[model samples]
Target: MRQITAILVGAGARGRFVYGEYAKKYPKELKIVAVAEPNEERRQLAAKDHGLSSNQLYESWEQVLDGAVMADVAVISTQDRMHCAPTIKALELGYDVLLEKPMSPLSEEVNTMANASRKYNRLLTVCHVLRYTPFWSKIKEIIVSGGIGQIVSIQLSENVGYYHMAHSFVRGNWNKAEETSPMILQKSCHDMDILSWLIDQRCTKVSSYGSLLHFRPENAPVGSTLRCTGGCVVERECPYSAVRIYEEDDPCNEWNRFITNKLTPEGIREAIEHGPFGRCVYRCDNNVVDHQVVNMEFESGSTASFTMSGFSHDISRTVQIMGTLGEIRGYMEKSEIVLFPFGGEAIEVPVTVEEGGHGGGDEGLMREFLKQVRNENSNDDQGLTSAEASLQSHLMAFAAERSRLEGGKSVTIAEMMELQFTQVKGVASPNKVT
Candidate 1:
């Protein structure tokens, strides 16, 4: 197999750890030829890891794109707001793109990106990694096979672990909705995509309710300081203490390394004392909801309810699907799927949970993306997640957010798309498609 060369746009955690690491493990299958990262340390680290020469290293994405096109694919793992321009430019430059999700925070931008992909005839796959996992894939197969008959309803919950919520939302980069995006788009877009994919129908309407409930100053323990390193009174008991989570003497595991590059005790202590990760969860500038519930009505008249909470003990997705003939219940963490047939014996399907991030979804998606780019696996059975197909989920999320803010008024997907089209009519080119 000819190796597929790639240029990385962002050398952040997702760029380097999730997507770019595939090049390291499968050197014969893929290669990272160039990298564009503003951070000097990260650029050097990525260059050294990918064995790229100095000429291949760029200080910014604009610099990489300013020169000639260098690779077959561009792994665009930039921040949410930064996805649109680079993605469209890469497609125009004759490079297939693997974009990190929530594709863009704005629906119009996502639509524009999708249109560019169609116009350029370039592959644009979003990193909806959950769809590539064996656990969810099996469920999809069972549903499609009529194991549960026609889908009637789905109840899904994404339980964001408390520590993770603190690390990413409270004290990390995605803390503010105004800056990054809403909690739904930033974190739960994966769930929304999964829900839409499983139902196999467009989301017609959505209603939601949520808030930034407990992670506020009023709920903080008395005598708690602004930062965990500020000698808080409840540092020992607080689960979200920055010092306890990041400054511990834990081994540098794959997950920990991705969060904070500084793994040593002293390094972690210094980061906490100076970085955003050290701020008290209750005292951060976060405005996104800590918990949310969305009710979706698909075009097929099937209903689904999704709940995202930041206070779970474990980070996992639990789903229950009801059909005309039976029902399916699954716990993503346990990798167990149970089928209950009407007046029949229950069937319990054992799912082999792969060992890696997102239940091995990161590697699964990377492999599928490489195959797609190489034209090795063109069949639909490969479950390739295209940018166009993933757009509905993002639209659904945008509508859900609107509904949530509008006092749970039911928001139709068509209305959201139409609004986006009108809003971007002057800005977006004439390649719009329904």
Candidate 2:
């Protein structure tokens, strides 16, 4: 095996903690050679971790890719909308890309990215890390091996968890749809991608129903202060209180530091009193839905149902795949799976969870990407979450969002594919579904 050099495009949490940690743990397999981050703190932090020289650090990805193809691959963990430009430029400049998911919120940008990948003949892989997890991999193996026969339907529940919803959707970087993406795309596209992969079929049609039911000004509690750190009458009882959740409990955690990199109690107090994360969850300007349900029809005539909610007690996922011969059910938090055959006994399987984020999927994805880049693995590997595969999932999310705004009207993927993404008053513009 050969060592593959990589450029870090964003030194945010995922880039620094997940991918950068991988390089640190296995320097022989992968090495981080350069970094391009807009923030001085994160950029310098990356440089320190990777031992990068001044010449190897750039303030933006444009500068990193402008001079030369500095590394074998560019790892793009930029903000949601920023994924397209750097990815396309890297491919054009003779570099493969490991891009973060929800490639783009716009259909046109997604299409342009796919075109760039094929035109440049570059290896483009989306970080659909869920597919690489031991839990999901076991499920895929069973379906491929015909352990449960032909796949008839799949049901997935994405429990976003209550505090997570408050931290991310209500007050975090993804607070507003216009700033980032709709909740479905930013948060649940993984679920959409997983469903398409497990069913091994294209989603033909999609319809969804959801809205910002609980996280809006209209839903704010009476007499509540604008910020949780304020002397609100209900501070002690509010579940989304910044005082309790951020400063008191996980003061030094990533989510708290995300609001302000200070990570100290005083800095957190100051941040909550003035910054976004400190605002009352229900009094904020969040427009994304707090809960949603999507129904999809696949090319094979099978159906799949997915639901995402912000009220779960734990941040986890549950799946049940119904097949012609039997059914397979699994809970991700437990890492336990059960197989039940027709008129047969139930069998339980134990999954060995590796020590990494996303149930070891993060590490698994990096491993596979390195193998592919080194020509040790096939680019056409059935498990590769390439740009084309992730494109379908993105389109599925767009169709679902269009359906949500149109009163759950059925929207076909073909219609979404045909129309260019435009924002004339709102997205899914012209309402042209022909």
Candidate 3:
């Protein structure tokens, strides 16, 4: 067996979880040899949690790659803006890369990263995990089987629950549009990627409109501070109380125990007060849209609508597809597919969940990624969305943001790509992180 040593950049929540799985589940196939993080505390926690020796820790990716060819692969799960540098560096250092999605905060960076992968002839896979889910695979199969013939339109809406959106974009790292683009790019790029893959078409133009209506600093109710549970008069009415929501053992909580326990209660208190989540739900520095609608036209003569809302009652995606002969409606979480023929009643099709993150795509993604890395035969037995396919969809969000800001003008995919190419061609790639 080829022993593949891996390095994890960003010792944050998702990075730690992926590293944990590598350590516990696929120890024989992949070994986490090192970690790079600028955050001293997070670095230490990751080292302690993953049992890394001092020699295996680095303050930055530059330090890790400095005369050290220790990792067979570099997992780039850093901030959106920081993705391109480390990933390109990893490839330059003769390591394959598994990049986390949205590719980068800016379209130019994404093109540069893609260019580096091609230039280096390295296996650079983005973590577009949706292509790995069992439910999505079934959906794709149904569509390919012509469960709805000659597809013409698709309506996909993401219900990014109030708490989830608040936790991630409101109080999290994705609050600012300049820093992250719209919530569309930051959160829905995955959906966009999957949608493009499902339709097998290039998005020609996109026009989007949305705004941060609810979670603004000015929208805080009477007598409410940043945090709802702390001293707000409406604490009883708000459901996002840090105490009530996070006190018990939940999936998100368990996911963070490795790091959360390291923070003292007072530390947590201070963070909540100062962090994005601690802000009033109706009042924050967040500029990303809480509710958005995007109209897209695909090159294949099909149309699509994408809606993302933060105030949804639940976390699920409801999709509708219209075709020449029939129509299909499905829910991602429920895993149900219903087809309505042009002249007949609806028929039910079954869909079920696998068992990990994002409707069980995490594990399925790992399976395919590992198989590919190990040179094992892998197939779309359970649908697998490739890097190029996923990248096309993710880029739509960036294009849509441009459209949204430019008075709802239609932005062409080709135009956006040309702009990115020009910008990246002018920028020199960073020196290998070493």
Q: Against the true structure, whose TM-score is highest?
A: 1
Task: Please say which candidate is ahead in TM-score: 1 or 3.
Answer: 1
Give the per-residue lDDT of model 1 (tens digit) for 211-298. 9998888898998998887979899888877766766643312234544566776776677787787888888888889999999998
- How well does candidate 2 score on lDDT at residue 12? 91
**Residue 152 error, candidate 2, Å:** 1.9
Q: After superposition, how far is residue 43 of candidate 2 from its true place, in Å?
A: 1.4
Candidate 3 backbone collisions, by pair? 62-433, 171-276, 171-277, 216-282, 216-283, 216-284, 217-283, 217-284
Ranking, TM-score, top scorer first: 1, 2, 3
Worst 10 residues of 3 by lDDT: 376-385
| Candidate 2 weakest lDDT stretch, 10 residues | 425-434
What is candidate 3's local distance difference test score? 0.74
User: Per-model C-alpha lDDT, please?
Assistant: 0.85, 0.86, 0.74
- State the lDDT at 3 in candidate 3: 60
TM-score of each: 0.95, 0.93, 0.89
Q: What are the runs in model 2 whose C-alpha is more than 4 Å off?
A: 250-254, 376-383, 420-434
Tens digit of per-residue lDDT, candidate 3, span 1-434: 66667889887777877655655566777778899989887888778876798888999988887886786678888888788788888889887778888787666677677667667766777788877877778778878998678779999999998668767777677878677556787789888887887888788998988888887766677877666546888866676555444443444443124324446667555555554446666766677788888999998789999999998867889999898888888888887888798888988877666777788887777666666666732222212444455568766887778777777888888877777666667753211100
Count backbone clashes in candidate 2. Answer: 0
Model 2 lDDT tens row, 308-411: 99998778999999999999999987898999987899989778788787888999999999988898333455237888898889989989998999999999
